[model samples]
Target: MKLLYLSYLNSFKGLSREVWWLALVTLINRAGTMVIPFLSLYLTQDRGFSLEDVGTIMSCFGLGSLAGTWLGGKLTDRIGYYKVMVWSLFLTGVLFIWLQMLESFYAICSGIFVLMVIADSFRPATYVAMSAYSKHENKTRSVTLIRLAINLGFSAGPAIGGVIIASVGYFGLFWIDGVTCLLAALLLLLVLNPKKAKELDQVKNEAPRSAYSDYPYLLFIGAMVLLGLIFVQYFSTVPLFYSEMRSLSEVGIGLLLAMNGFIIFVFEMPLIKYLETSTLSRTSLMIIGLAMTTFSFFFLTIGTWTGLLVIGMILMTLGEMITFPFSSAFAMDRSRSGRQGEYMALYNIAFSISHIFAHNGGMVSIANFGYKSTWYLAMIIGVMGILLLYALRYRLQTSRKK
Candidate 1:
């Protein structure tokens, strides 16, 4: 037992204090994300809103996220990561508190829209700080560790949310989520104030800006937007699929999500080490992950057993483990120094846009083509993404030889 404890302590010996603080802050923030996965259910079931109304509200959030992504990146470059994060957290907490008090559909929609903007603004700032802090050797690991922290919180948050909702309902969940946000903000302010001299220098060295510019960056942003649309089905449709099949209880779904977190926490570090030696680039891993996620949906359509669902969830988690870090790392690598915040913000837009598309598309697809067909559609998108990556690989290889 002593040996085990010492081994665990030794494992974290090489991580910087900043990384540790960031990881802790992420955990605090994610613990509050218990509200996200179940937000749709809360709106429809408890708050007495229609599915269409829920979609409308979420779409509003997506729109806000679109603006927030650009704003976040720009702000991070101008004001620094610490400042942006502080305000983002404080505003997000206030918004969550406001959300708890809302009664009407319009009020809920408006409140959530504003909250999403504030909540999302922190994303690019956090990523920029992480990228700036990491060395090339440990960059992937650093990003993966951050992801691991998120998965850890994600693992617990929903299960806790389930119990809270069952016992005290949606308002309780909101209250807890708001309180955690404030705590996370405080932690960020106290513990993670890394230097930003390099970031400031990068901004000063950039060329004069054109209002009509940002086109090349926008192209990558567009691709990420499509990718987000394809990926959002996992959160929005997958659970609904399982629920419809009557294969898992609410607690069971929470457990499955927790399993995803555990897999990442336990395996991501070693997996990153192994992949580092492989010929595969970050883009290649993303393609592979997408393919696996697409394939998992097929299993979902065919099997209703708990065991099969678990297997499918494992595959999806594996895909997530591969794609998320690689995508973030690759996006950061492509970004210019001063523009890191904007690049990361663009990357986040993909997620927001995808969420809206998936919710709307999934509903239509499920109604018309059934759940199996919806999975097939996701498979098709995965294929397209793979093809795009392959084309990119060829272009890169050809250019290198020249």
Candidate 2:
């Protein structure tokens, strides 16, 4: 046990202090992530909107994400990531506080769309900052560390958010989320300086390349979109599954979701550290992760047993731990010095597209066919993602031989 504890500490040994600060910022921001997870339920139960209306509002979220990420990337390349992140966080906080006031369906949809535009712009900027802060050898682990922070925050967020919702209603969640965002922005201001980030960036010079023109990278992005389409169900639809199909309370559903975050928080870093030393390629590991994610749906289809939910979440979390950090490392490595923001932005946009489809698609599937059918559909998408990853691996191998 002593040796194991030491090894776990060793995993974090080589990272820079800036990376730790970035993780802290992410943790603070994500800790208040209450609204999105419960938005569908709030719209339907509290606001009396139809599932179709909920789907449309969520699609608006996707569209805003697409625009936000693209704009963030462009600005990061031109101005730098620090300014983009600061402004995004501050503006997002202000918008969230205002978001709870809208009563009409169209007003809610428009408000959400604009709010996501300001909020999601932080994503690509954050990725560029990671590249600035991290050394090349530890890049994947660095990404994993940030993910660990996110999961740790998520683990607490839902459990705490569940209680907040129960006591003060959904609007209270908005207030907390807004305040946290403001706090995160302030913390970021105190910690990371843009001039220092430029000094820390290792890649000094390289030819510029357009992410849109990179065919192999675009193929990889496509596979990510498919995987994301399935993965995002946990946030957007799966809670509803726990509430409606399984008859779980809000707290019960929150705990179930929190289980995913807890597993990732405890296990992901050590697992990634071990995987980093292994001989298996990143693509190969991702294929295995995708396979695990596919089977998570299979578990759900087997029965209504609550134990199956736990089992499925464990598998899904393990898969996410394997796939996401490596995927991020791959995206960063593919980027040239001048265009890192663009490449990562395109990478984020892939998931943004998935958000667009996943929320609306999953809801429509559940509403039209039922929960079991939705799980089956997710399984199919997961399989397709695995196959696409294989194709990408083959093309990459062919290019390397040349």
TM-score of each: 0.84, 0.88
Whole-model Cα lDDT per candidate?
0.75, 0.87
Per-residue accuracy of model 2 over 1-402 as CA lDDT, tens digit each? 998888889888889889999999999898876777788888998899998898788788778889999898888888878999999999999999999899998899899989988888899989888987888878889999998887778767877888999999999999999999999999899888764543355565556888888888888899899999999998878888888888999988878887786777667788998998999998999899889888898887888889998898889888998999999998988885348889999999999888777877898999999989999999988989898899989999999999
Model 2, position 157: C-alpha lDDT score: 87
Which lDDT tens digits does candidate 1 get at residues 1-402?
A: 786556545444455567767888988898887998899898888888988898788788788787777788889878878889889988888788788889998888788878888888888888877776666656677788888788778877988999999999888888888889999998887776554223221334355343125444454455455566566776777888777775678888878867876788767776776676688887788778877776777777674567888888888888877878787787666665336676777678677777657678887998999888888888887777667666666665676899
User: Which runs of model 2 end up more than 4 angstroms from their true locations?
Assistant: 38-55, 101-104, 162-172, 197-201, 235-256, 303-310, 366-376
